[model samples]
Target: MFGCIAAGRLVQTNLQQVDVNKYVFELSDPQSINHLVVFLLGTIPFEPGYAATVHLLWPNKDWQLLGGLSNEKPSAIFRIGGGKNNIMMNQPTATLGISIEPIETVQQLLSTLSSGVMKSGGSNLQHAVSMTEVGQMASRVIENLFNYVTSFAVQDLPMNGIALGEVTERGYLPVKAFQTWYNNLSRKLANDPNYLSSEKSA
Candidate 1:
């Protein structure tokens, strides 16, 4: 069972298996999902502290897929009853708690930034990004931006957004997970102005 507490309500979705590289959920409500908790069910094949590459992909302003990676390793033995959400395994398992608010905030901020850049007679976002040396500069800017934003945003969340010490690792890691969730929520909100307006009014 796949479970997440969305909008303070626990929602459980049952699935036998998730394709390794496939996007699992396209959320219908982004704002409602304040916090996300993901559990790795199976035993890992590697030793403790062995890292796994986490991939992330999301469309930019032009809908071009921008990819990123996170080298997340299970560092410590996570105990279930000790407030750690990860299950222990032959190889340690890791849990990632993603707070979606900052992602949305940055998404909105980027749109505003892009507009500001254009209005200031500055070069387009793509043009401002250098294409030299494989060009990770743009990616680095986004990664840093998310972390910068999340630092402040996490302060406002419960327990300071630290469910598990490792779970709270945010910003560009475990890609595709939150990006897919964020986009799904964005699409739903875009399609439902009435609900969006109601939310604002409420």
Candidate 2:
């Protein structure tokens, strides 16, 4: 009944029944991914009264509503990358919780999801698709969004010397990674200046 497209590969998710109406699934590598597209498979659409609410597990353990999908509308897009969505993970994967319980749930899904994901304000990347076109425009949408890479709300360091390691998500590395790299190059040049004349790690 549900499907997810992450990093251009498609997966037919197996929804494990937790409660009578609640189901859960794992979304792998949400940190490295730029977007996540969730959709109803349309094999068993909602029966007019019942609907599904999609939720992404927050870092603090709260289930925040990612979006929802139903019979009329079956697909939605989520900006899960390093922008305003800023979804950081302790490990590599994330948990996706879906609840197909109430009409209030359906309304909540459609309230923000709308017919399409991009609703003006910013540069519109992908247009919303029709019911028949469910889950088809995901790649195109991602491609369009890729063109506007500079527009994303990425975190930036205001000044220099912000000590950061490889694990830090934001790009404020004050040492190592870059400093160590350049420092090593400078030290090599200062020491020998002909270090590159010899074979190095290949």
Candidate 3:
């Protein structure tokens, strides 16, 4: 059995509007699902810390957290049972996954930013100006946020199979793990001006 749940929250604006959508899905089967595959399609904006949790109902009950793919399209696969004779017996046994697809929200956000900049005549300017300064500051904030999240993900990623299995049992790493690593990495990077300059140049 496979089912999907979708929900969204709408935010209204004078110039543009946004809707944040979240999808939660589940799959269950009496006959063991051996080679299961999931594909996340489209260019939907993904939420930070989002993950897909898969549980196996078989001889050895275990759970796995699907990691994100670096490509534009993301997919994951898992092997459940070992032998053909092994069957999934547990009733209502399910694997749950959540996908955060922020489609309209991102478009609206970009539109709003563009409109604001155009209205302020920022686009007309050719050189560094006050508006350029503000734009650079905003870009830095966004870049910092992206770097922080990526660093956290890298540090929190399981170093070994045992650690990965532990994450499957625990659902996800604690928020503190991400926060601690993010802060530490951010501080280290901030303190290294040469590294920062090189990164910026790159």
Best by lDDT: 2
Q: Best by TM-score, which number?
A: 2
Clashing pairs in 2: none
Model 1, runs deviating above 4 Å: 1-7, 14-20, 42-202
Total backbone clashes of candidate 3, pairs 3 or more residues apart or in separate chains: 0
Residues 163-185 of candidate 2 have per-residue lDDT tens digits of: 33222343333332333343544
Candidate 1's displacement at residue 69, Å, is 11
RMSD of 1: 18.5
Please provide, for model 1 over 79-153, each residue's C-alpha lDDT reduced to its tens digit, 9 standing for 90 to 100: 123222222222222222221122233233334433412111122122122221122332332233244334443
Question: What ranking of all candidate models by lDDT puts the best one first?
Answer: 2, 3, 1
lDDT of each: 0.29, 0.54, 0.34
What's every prediction's RMSD, in angstroms?
18.5, 17.9, 19.3
**Model 1: lDDT of residue 129:** 26
Query: What's model 2's lDDT at 6?
Result: 61
Model 3 stretches astray by more than 4 angstroms: 1-23, 45-63, 66-73, 82-87, 99-202
